[model samples]
Target: MSDNRTWRARLIATSAPAAVIWIRVYVGVVFLTEGILKFTRPDTLGAGRFDKAGIPAPGFFAPVDGVFEIVCGALILAGLVTRLAVVPMIVDMVGALLITKLPIVWGDAPLFARESGFGDFLHEARLDFAQLCGSVFLLLVGAGSWSVDARLTATARSAASH
Candidate 1:
């Protein structure tokens, strides 16, 4: 009983404003779409692009990243374990900035991410930066009032009181 309460206590600890659902929705859709596009448009977004970026083992890593994005995006959309779900996405974005955007900023542009100047880097990196920030926000907040986490926490609290 005591152990269960401890677990429930941790679960019940999260509280967030409903506004965060907006961030979750945006982040989730973007990630999910990017993942699906990796499969549907492989030449542009998946292994081919990775190859152009000189990523090692492009075929293996791209698909793995796609699957990771899909699963994590779905979890974020459903507001389930959002804090945990966003961790992979955070890693994903950081890797993206390093692999794709940083090269552009350094003027050694990848095949697809070629840019004329630092301005191009800023423009191209905007989306990646936004998604990275959104993932961080979700990680900090742990979903919001309109989430599975909230419902589950509420349920846990009720059950505990009984």
Candidate 2:
């Protein structure tokens, strides 16, 4: 029983890193899709949306935000420099929540609606909150054992020991 328990523990510990790949892939795809949509449907999520949202310099900032999302998303998807890639994404989500979502929660009218209750606001902002938390998690845990960062680290360690 003791030996069996020890093997089970080892298996669980070794398998934990596999979970990060799913998180990384899901978050990366979401960010990437958002960026692509901003470019493909500029009127909906790009400058037009920014203008409606009252973001200053919408023309300049909208495309800039899209570019950041694209680049960071790509980096994360490749599992290269994932920790660094998530920083910009984290900032983007926070900015999105603060600028767009919180107003509705605080009794300010939503852009499309005359008014929104807190429950509605919470429902709307759920994705933003999830993305924000996911980004923070990746920032802390990094790309994990199956990633380019891990390969690089292993190479460096091997070289150092030689």
Candidate 3:
């Protein structure tokens, strides 16, 4: 259908700078590693942490969240549907900020975490902020010339012109 084509075109099209790769690499690596850590460091970042943070259904959401990070991280790293990949990441980061970091801002750090002041909140949330910014940037800019999305877009344009 035309709607599907329109969505595909939007997802693949790109005019981003090549330097965008650096941002993608950083964000992708951080997410990929963090996802792996959820399994490897359950007591600190997986269900245990979610439980301590007062998230409902910690057992189910932890692994699901980790899986989304892992899959979306790889997708962004490969520059395939970069914008679409980052959408979920943006949501995830915001959710993390609200559920985990907001408490620190309110002077009541979650059980697994600790914070007494805004400075501590900043210290604890630097990475989350960075990741959120990076994801938002990618969402606005699209994948760059060096990306798989760019190549596919070029190919599609070429075919359409013929």
Q: Best lDDT goes to which candidate?
A: 3
lDDT of 1 by residue, 116-149 (tens): 5788888888999999999998877788989988
Best-to-worst order by TM-score is: 3, 1, 2
After aligning candidate 3 to the native by TM-score, how far in Å is the CA of 161 from where it should be? 0.9
Collision pairs in model 2: none
C-alpha lDDT values of all predictions: 0.86, 0.78, 0.89
Q: 20 in model 2: Cα distance from truth in Å?
A: 0.2
Greater-lDDT candidate between 1 and 2: 1
* Model 2 TM-score relative to the real fold: 0.86
TM-score of each: 0.91, 0.86, 0.93
Estimate the lDDT of model 3.
0.89
Model 3 misplacement above 4 A: 1-5, 111-113
| lDDT digits (tens) for residues 1-162 of candidate 2 | 233344322222211275788888888998988988888988889988888888999889889999998888888887778878898999999998888877886677446465577887788788888888888888777777777767765665566568
